[model samples]
Target: MADAEMVRRETSFWRHAVVTVPAILLLGLASGWVSNSGYGNPWFDGLAKPQAMPPGWTFGAVWTTLYILLGVALAFILQAPNSGTRRTALILFGSQMMLNFLWSPVFFGMHQPRLALAIIVVMLVLSIATTFWVARIRKAAAWLMVPYMVWLSFASILNYEIIRLNPAS
Candidate 1:
């Protein structure tokens, strides 16, 4: 009986890991793609940035950390037992993630901070909604998202400031 239970637990751990590692990696990949695609472009370089803007490298570091947190939070929610809200939470999470993926292209690739700000606003709202959904299922998962929420809020403000600072951009 003891040996059977050990095997069962081990299997469960691996099962969760199979889902989690990829989720985290995928989020990291998306973050990398956005940063790489947007950074150092002529259009982005030409824009007037706010004084509050951190050094260029800081964005990559901060975003990578945030994306990892997002993945952990998502993994928890995804691994939770199937529930109706799980689906909703996943959808909301996915929507915000897609929006998150689009922000860089809109802001730097297309040189449209104004539009990016708009996208971030919606993304922020969806993120808050996702947090709530995850909270209902797994408090740890929800807590994992707190940093992401804070960062998104900060990013939204930064986007707004960029639009204001560079009206020409």
Candidate 2:
């Protein structure tokens, strides 16, 4: 009986993951594509890139993996019972998602690196909050966000460098 209950719970988590992973991946891909965030954007291509900037393809690869991890994290959170911590995690997660979706447009579409930097910083804070709140609800979910936080740290540095390098831009 215990094994059966465990399998059922595990199935529920998997079911949520199946829905969330693809949804987040599609949204992330769409956001980047719609805003022309990467190599082909004229403004982006002309910007003063940091010396440590990875290859163009690396962005897609890293983001794809990060989004999948985030989606799985969301699924883990979703499978948990309702509580104050869970609600806080959900709110923070949603805030992060909104900021994430807005970032490419703010930077690549509107050509506002400074504003985008602000957004990214707030997003990072919210993501950190989400991870902690998720830790209270689901420990594994918190681990899933580590890669995302690390990537955000790198991206923040890159954004700062772009602004520093192109003071006139």
Candidate 3:
């Protein structure tokens, strides 16, 4: 019985991962593409960038890795037995993702850095809450989310610096 249960749980995790990883990748890529974010965008290219900014290729690479990590974290959470903790984690995760999807549009499509910054701040907070809630159920799941939070912090700094450099923007 124990072995069967373990196998079932493991299968559940993989099944969720198969759905999660690709969805995250697609949604993230689509968000960036729809907004025309990054180097090719004329408005973004014209803005003064922070000195610490990485090359154009770096964003895609780092975000790809981070999104994969986040997807795995989410899969782990989803695989856990349903409960209030899991529900809270899922809520936080969905909320953060919504804001995540909104950021590119608000910043690049709408040209509103301040509002985008606010959205990022809230997203980061929700991500942290999700991490903590996931931690209550699965330590490894929470561990997977750490890099995302770290990257979000760095991205927030970059966003702030961009707004500071181009107050007119």
Each model's C-alpha lDDT? Answer: 0.79, 0.94, 0.94
- The per-candidate count of clashes, in order, stands at 0, 0, 0
Clashing pairs for predicted structure model 2, backbone only? none
Task: Let me know the TM-score candidate 1 reaches against the reference structure.
Answer: 0.84
| TM-score computed on alpha carbons, candidate 3 | 0.98
In angstroms, the error of model 3 at 91 is: 0.2
Worst 10 residues of 2 by lDDT: 79-88
Q: Summarize candidate 3's per-residue lDDT along 74-147 as a digit string, tens digits.
A: 89989988899999999999999999989998999898999999999999999999899999989998999998
Per-residue alpha-carbon lDDT of model 2 for 57-87, expressed as tens digits?
9999999999999999999999988888888
Between candidates 2 and 3, the one scoring higher on lDDT is: 2
How far in Å is the alpha carbon of 65 misplaced in model 3? 0.6
Error of 3 at 115 (Å): 0.6
Q: What is the lDDT, from 0 to 100, of the residue 167 in candidate 1?
A: 75
lDDT of 1 by residue, 1-169 (tens): 9999878755664576577657766765665466554457777777677788778788778777777777767767766668899999999999998888788777776777888899999999999999999999889879988888898898888888878888777
